[model samples]
Target: MKRRVAITGVGLIDPLNESINNFFARTIRGESSIRYFASKGDPVPVSIPAVYCADFKGDDLLGKHRTISMDRFSQMGLVAAFDAWTNAGFNVHDRSHKPNAGVSWGTALGGTRIYEQGLREMWINGRERLPPLSVVMGMNNACSSHIAIQLGLGNSSLTYSVACSSASAAIGEAYKRIRNGEANIMVTGGSDTPLIYGVIRAWDGMRVLSPGNEENSPSACRPFDKSRSGLVLGEGAAALVLEDWDHAILRGARILAELAGYGANCDHVNLVKPDSSGQAAAISLALEDAGIPPKDVGYVNAHGTATIEGDPSEIEALRSVFGRQAKELAVSSTKSTHGHLMGASGAVEAVITVLCLKNSIVPPTANLKDIDTSCEGVRHIRIGDSNKSDLKAAISNSFAFGGSNAVLVFKST
Candidate 1:
């Protein structure tokens, strides 16, 4: 028999809020966190509106000693992971429980801020100045490494870097590990702090970052709307504590929801553009893994980045998977409010999906005033929140730039 996985605890550090309850409450209120930031002597021509964790003080959460060696991204991960560890009722200082736990973190453009700072120091200062811990802090695996060391997880520590799908992939792999009995518990999530000057400039060159209307900066990310422009970059982290169902039951843990299935695939098409067929296959595969039929999914947390191409591609994929019933599914994209968190999008959205299942309230697609005709058929939860107490299962979709697609199925417990 396959071991079941239960989501016992969740942690979030985002532009909207840090705690799960606060984040969900703010999200359901249809508020957007995107704001304008003036360029700091960068080559970028204009200021852009982006989502940022304004009040996050890593030093306050991790302490001066622990924060000294970590970059902003890693610090966010450590803080979120710590929140999850405590929420799960585990003693972080107890080394005896460490052997049974592990960490799987996902990130895209890890520690880019440190790299950018290093480059500035070398080029502008005309000196070979660099931080002593720069190499370690700039590594892609640094967040996972720090999480493992800080939490004393000894079973395994892995980091995934699959563009936007990174976090979902990490969580899926963690679920498999628990199911295969490799570990009893896994702390899984993703983090990315990509709002720095260099990263934003690079993204701006790609023409994917939203060019906000000077009048209304917060309403820039208009996902599924006819006037949708592009995604607004955001930075944050979210973590989930996944435990074997039997172990959780024996320990009398309260189960938030069950991670029932996971599916991952690639488009094999474009480097940046998404393919409907590839996304459809991943959704179908996830349903198959969960032994669920298409009609049973009451909600879909779409990977709607508000890009002209992305929104249509995702809708097309949903149409393929649900067929005529696609029109009946309640779908929305929280990215409309939170902005895109790059690698951390999947993990943060997963937490939101679980909260929706637990609370029976679906967050709206903010700024979706006029739905694009292409996305018309789907029953999108737009503008305001919707209450659906009978929702049984929901799927969170994450399709990355490299054609990597990951789908996760969550069932109400």
Candidate 2:
């Protein structure tokens, strides 16, 4: 109960791969999933394209409501979780364990696709009329609930809806549960499908999204760069099998990485913009939790959304927390290649950080023509391709729309 937690298995379904192993292998080869193709027909201005999971048909992975009603985001979470559980070599209902298995899914906006669709049907059909599956499918917790039901995970099943940091927070909470003797295993992650027109329109209202970037599609996300304009939206889901370190070893499970510490802070200052001081505090708190010095951190997976306010604020946050070490740190944003997956951003990027440690490499920032003079001293890997090396420890930051900041520190297993 006093020790650490380890990632036993991880499954990802995004623009990169339908499976986790495939995604990591491809990433090591310096591949990207960003594309300019449009789903609605006509030449739509799409930038910061991401690796997106393809469509799913009726299947057991979709569970009981396979043919009925479900959103793309929830469906993807289920599929990814299915693979994650199998990869971890455990089943939710196995009599070998009790109360040890749990489910926690996070999302910024859950099942918006289902929500908008149901709303349209209701407006067209009237309250007297009905869409049979509206109630169960459109709810914000639907994704978590569905997976819980199919897996028989009982009351421990829950959802955290904290925008971009949602997934990392979910992972952090699960880590605590396992370490405190509450549970032995938990499946935690996030899902989102914001590529839909309705979803895009919601983000566009904030005026932080890119209109278009014709020349740099994959590299449209120029994090911490002077040429950085704004963030490009992307979507996907990722799930991790988190288990107690000893239990995973006893079960002969493969360890991906060790989750040493996690810290979450809220600005409570603004609804949209983050408080840089608050964000900096989160990282310092995480480092304290890990019992490690800031200089020991080898790399940082920055939030780096490339927004007008986000990049500089985070850079300053780093400077406040790590001081001179922040200047020499190898920081990069995967958002440049994958775009921001909203709810799933933190979870998926956490997986990326772990794998980068396991594989002894760092994925490139994708697009960095000119560095911002303000961020000059901070070491951001401005290369356009993957670079290989031994990574000892890494920090991942995810800041969301509601001024929620989540930071996690991972060490080699």
On TM-score, the leading prediction is 1
For each candidate, how many residue pairs have backbone atoms clashing (under 3 Å)?
0, 2
Give the lowest summed-lDDT range of ten residues in model 1. 37-46
lDDT of 2 by residue, 1-413 (tens): 37789998887775744566677665554455666635453135433354455554425556554636666777888877877887778774564453567888888888777766666567655755556676666677787876776676653787898988999988888888887878888888988888776667667777787655445566667887888878888778889888889999987989989999989989888988878998998998888888889988888899988887888888889889888777778888888877888989888888999888888887767676687876665777756543666777999998877788889999997
Q: Against the true structure, candidate 1 has what lDDT?
A: 0.90
**lDDT of candidate 2 at residue 177, scale 0 to 100:** 86
Per residue, candidate 1 scores C-alpha lDDT tens digits across 1-413 of 78999999898896755567877987887778788866576655558888888799988878989888889999999888988888888877877768899999999889888988888889988767687999899999999999999889999999999999999999999999998899999999999999888788789999888887557889999999999999988899999999999999999998999999999999999999889999999999999998889998999999999999999999999999999999989999999888899999999999999999999878889999999998887898876546455778999999999899999999999
Q: How much lDDT does candidate 2 score?
A: 0.78
TM-score of each: 0.97, 0.91
Question: All candidates' lDDT scores?
Answer: 0.90, 0.78
TM-score of 2: 0.91
Question: lDDT (0-100) at residue 395 of candidate 2?
Answer: 93
Which predicted model would earn the best lDDT?
1
Tally clashing residue pairs in candidate 1. 0
